[model samples]
Target: MHKLWNRIPPLASDYSGVCSILFELNSLNILYTPSGCVHPIVEVDEIRNFDNVFFYKSNLSDIDVIMGVDDKFLAEAELLVLNNPNLEFISIIGTPVSNITNVDFQKIAEELERKTKIPVIIFNTNGFESYNVGIYEGLLMLAKGLSKEAVRNPKHINVIGYSTIALGYKYHLNELVKVLENIGLKVTFFASDGCIKSITEAAKAAVNFVISPEGVGAAEYFKEKFHIPYFMDIPVGLNGISRVLKLLGTHLNVDLSEIEESIVTRTELRGINEYINKNVLIIGEPLTSIGIRECLRADFVINNITIITNLNSTKKSREIYKEDLFSQVIFVEDEEHVAKYISQADIIIADPLYTIFIRKEDNKIFIPLPHIGLSGREFAKMEYEYVGKMGFEYFKKFLKSEV
Candidate 1:
């Protein structure tokens, strides 16, 4: 018998991913699903605060589903376009119904674009895949659809795979931008956050920074199409931050000596040995989990470290944890397995959703590091203030308060 899922909620679906990529853009987002599917994005996702995003729901009823709703989709899309002259673009996102009915949204999107005289992109995201897959696909389509040929600017860079749902995303990006600017580099565009005009000018950037693993595919596209060099790293903690600065300086041949000196002076303000003997568990997507592990291990001489995630293991991911830093590296699917690890660890650093699996009686210190896939927008307000010296200071404060 299939075990019932009463303890843990389902992970965010491909539909959520499609919506996330389009969240900040000044475009019309239409979800072709039953009315119920809309609740997850509207109620659970972070875009609730973004009033600028134009969203619509095509509530396919049982009869409409059986008869098929191609004409209905065309009619509604045309009407929306007619009504909203200010609309920059339109995205048609599919749910499980599209998969079941075998609807070809790509062809429909082409037709709609022709009919409306407006750019229409379709993401037939069946609920079968996880959020990461959806995010990768959506961003890839966006990059291909929007980025145009232009003269490359050697000092400008684009940050790809950036999502509004990430914890402290704005603050962290601002911090990184300051450092980049200090070295005479500019952030030309944030792939997901900027306007369509900015996205179209993406090829102008001299380099691309793939901040999340979700953005790797998009960065690869930029490299091949525009020949823009890309860097794949999410610089967390002081050491990681230093490495990022040095690597970028070396690549661009910039004088980052002043920034390096500032970083050195800041390091003396905090000691790394304070976390000695503390048992810490890092859990989330592979890229994020690895980042946290590097940061925590660098500053604190923790007695035990455990990294847990459900992301597929690749050669690179395996190489990251090949060292003897983690006592155990767990790739778990079910909540029971995750709960087992939570029970053993003294401190749990994971998405808020995992907290549901933890036993109430256990005095485990829960530090919420929100992941879009796990908790949607529940903790969207929380900033991931864990980058550079400020990030190190944040950890020190957190350790003191919790441990």
Candidate 2:
């Protein structure tokens, strides 16, 4: 029954891993339960050098879970906010214990906010749902808060769904800003590490880019209430950028060819197409998993693409790439198990989880194919950002290798 329920959940939570991504994106200052393990600490430490981070400890006990969020912890949070004059907000993430207790987190946050005169955002992080659900819920919470403080600014567009958890988010955003500015469009918000003032100006943008489905609800809200136009599923690849520019053209009533030439066309697709015929395993967010699957097929005779995605979050991407292309596309729930399968494949494209174990002797080429939407050119930008000047050094090696 336990096994059945584990598989039955539409989107099981992997909180430890997801929170690390959230932290990498600089979206929140996560508080840890005393009993929590080292995963968050490790991931947070990895990304800490890239951004500002602060942590707080909450010594939650089993007794507290059975009863509710200990009043003492809430009081501690309030005290911490009061002591830190520079603090802007506090996020209360739900732990497994808290979920089991069915604590009224919203009430606790409201009380904390009222007490500290600081914003308290409650996010459910029970490791029972997929990361996308957590991201979407977190964004919704952010939107609700921003809505109250939103300022009307016309001609700016909010870029939602590209969180800091993604590799090379800074580089990608900078490039995007330049591309949009070249076309005379102003970027209003980044949705990740984005300034509060800028986010409040979201209503000011002429159109919003629903870069990921996580932003779908926010985009719909703005369109319905503020009459802003929205373009959904604009990812980080050369062709993906082209699709975005075309959408912008339609919205602005301008020509798209020039924009495409300047951004997508000038860039080269990494010659990985020649090796696409080799059996490859893909694991990451659905947008990335599915987008790469289609993009690679254009160049390689993609044998199979084993996916590690929660179906609910990847519905849109799934609709784009049916089960026909791959010899088989399996939905994975465990990272370790998936990694073992990846070890058997000719090539592997994924985030750090899968890449951490690959060896030179295995003859399995590993590409840092994060699902953040970089095509050939955008990926180059990422390689430069995190890996320093050696950017693409590893990826390029993969491209040159024969499957």
Candidate 3:
């Protein structure tokens, strides 16, 4: 047996990732697994609010797994497509059972597509990989299957990689859109909010703004196929927002003088400078951790930072911003590893699941930020603002009051 406890729970599984992307589009999403496999995604994640999107779960019984029930799976999919004539697309997501049985989900998807004349996408997510991998694969499949060649519009852009798993993502994206619009840029489509039609129209946009690292695959696909360049940055916090706007301005050759002035004024008005002495520990996906770190360092001068993430540190994430704020960057898989670092921090910013590992005697401040992989949407009802000047203000307020 291992000496240390494996405290770190599995981050959002691959199926969650496929569901996150599919939930945004106008498609009928079906999880090919037993009844229990669908609960975590449906009850805990953000799909609870997506009443318009159709989602179904297949009944894979004991005999089905032992004896192979490909016929049952195909018939169920056929029935759904026949009943819902207006359905744009069908996505079949795999679970642990399907993976173990070596089920040929792709072949079944092809068969379904041929029979119903409806486009079908399959993700063989066996719950072994994390959400980031799932999101990358899901987005790549969407781009490859749906994007078509078209004339480009210099003024339009498609924002990619805004997922439901991000805490307060809707508010963050809305603010980012407002800032872009202020600079006279049109957001043709938000990749996370579009369907097959949106993916087809992506070729018309001049650029793809990859807000998260997960969207990089989709952005690269557009670049090679449509000759569209991408700007990789999630504009969070005051400094984070300013940096993104400046980059956007340079690329588009637009004057963001007014926007810059407004951002500086807003930061000053928020009085974020008062909390410079605070120390923070950030843990999450790579881009999110980086964005929050940049924001905290720039606005509040919280330089005593430590970043713990599931992604590799060498893959351009550490070098994204020239100014380094992280004192230590730890890539972790075990709970004991996370515990060693958490013991030294005064403020902990992470998913709610990490709270269980913290010692009761340790006097530390915790700000609950929900992550789909960690706590899912259990605490999504509690709003945590972490984008734009106003988001920074909310962050400052959170620290001042919570600590």
Candidate 4:
């Protein structure tokens, strides 16, 4: 009853997040559930489902649940591996049905690996938790299973924890790759950007750029195993990217302040003085909302920024760029509480769906920032830039600061 909401749909579940991560890999993904469970993932959250990845749902019947039948699952997985010799690995994702029935996903994965002789990654993602949790688990598994122990390169860096579900990968990350390359840092791997080699050799990078909370687990794993260091911030806007380069250069004991500034920067402004002293509240995933806040405060026009986020990983992380800079922070658990905060803002920067809490008649301004976790396919098909110099320009549209 506490989780029930009248207008807003539930955010993408853990399995969807796990599936989004697996969607990028060259492996067969088996989501264990009853019938009709995979629709929301393919139809909504996963906008780039090309029907090429071996994605299947284990149609566990009522009797199978009662009997704990796993032989059929093993046989199906073995057959798939036998047929697809090019498969790199396999992913076993769980749903609410498996969670309630006390399914031992580890045992199932062990058996499947023995039968297929290929590595099997398991995400016991019951549908109850949010998608970022599943993504966090999936990426950590990839870090442990696929990334190899290799010699590190000082000029190489990997963009960790970004997923396709964010819906800004094509425009945002592609530009980011070019920017990092131009700065003399080779982007060795970008997680879940559909590069299998990037994932496998992720350890070779001298450092990792952890852009989201989903990458925390994998970043920590690499830090512990391969002794790779990481920073938790995306080079968002023009000023933001320069600050990020400085941060990276500091970590490697190199100076990038001497490097030419980004081509993009804060504009003279079409009209932002009205929002200068306004109380701005940014609602979205942790890293994203924080990046927006960083962008807004770069010129010091909007200092009163509040962040509402879903993941717990960012707050606990060290060396996160200006994590304590926010005026306030709220962990999203209850809808009513979120609405109460939404009503208090002079301006709100969040997905369009969140605007439902605020009436049009109200004087409050709503900045439409699309998050895949909030609206799924509603914004997936649309164009939204949330990375690099162009991303800041896209964000600048709502701020009325485009020059």
Top lDDT model: 4
lDDT of candidate 3? Answer: 0.73
Pitting candidate 1 against candidate 2, the one with the higher TM-score is 1
lDDT at residue 186 of model 2 (Cα atoms): 69
**What TM-score, over all chains together, does every model reach?**
0.87, 0.71, 0.88, 0.90
Worst 10 residues of 3 by lDDT: 314-323
Put down candidate 2 lDDT per residue, 87-149, tens digits, no spaces. 656777776656666777777778877877777677767655444555566666666666543
lDDT ranking, best first? 4, 3, 1, 2
Cα shift from native, residue 55, model 3 (Å): 1.6
Encode model 4's per-residue lDDT on 98-140: one tens digit a residue. Answer: 8888888889899988887888888788887777777777788
Return the number of clashes found in candidate 3: 1
Q: What residue runs in model 3 are displaced by over 4 Å at the alpha carbon?
A: 1-8, 167-169, 266-278, 310-328, 359-361, 399-403
Clashing pairs in 3: 12-373
Alpha-carbon shift of residue 330 in model 1 (angstroms): 3.3
lDDT of each: 0.72, 0.55, 0.73, 0.75
The lDDT, on a scale of 0 to 1, for candidate 1 is 0.72
Q: lDDT tens digits, residues 1-403, model 1?
A: 0234466666677678778878778888998876877887788755457565688887568778767878887888888888898888889888888788888788889899989878887777887666666777788888888778989888888878776544334666577778778667877545555578668888888888877766777888988998888877777777667778777777677767677778645444333444556678878766666667777766654547788875434343343335453325676656676777888887888877777767778877787777766677667667556667777676666676233
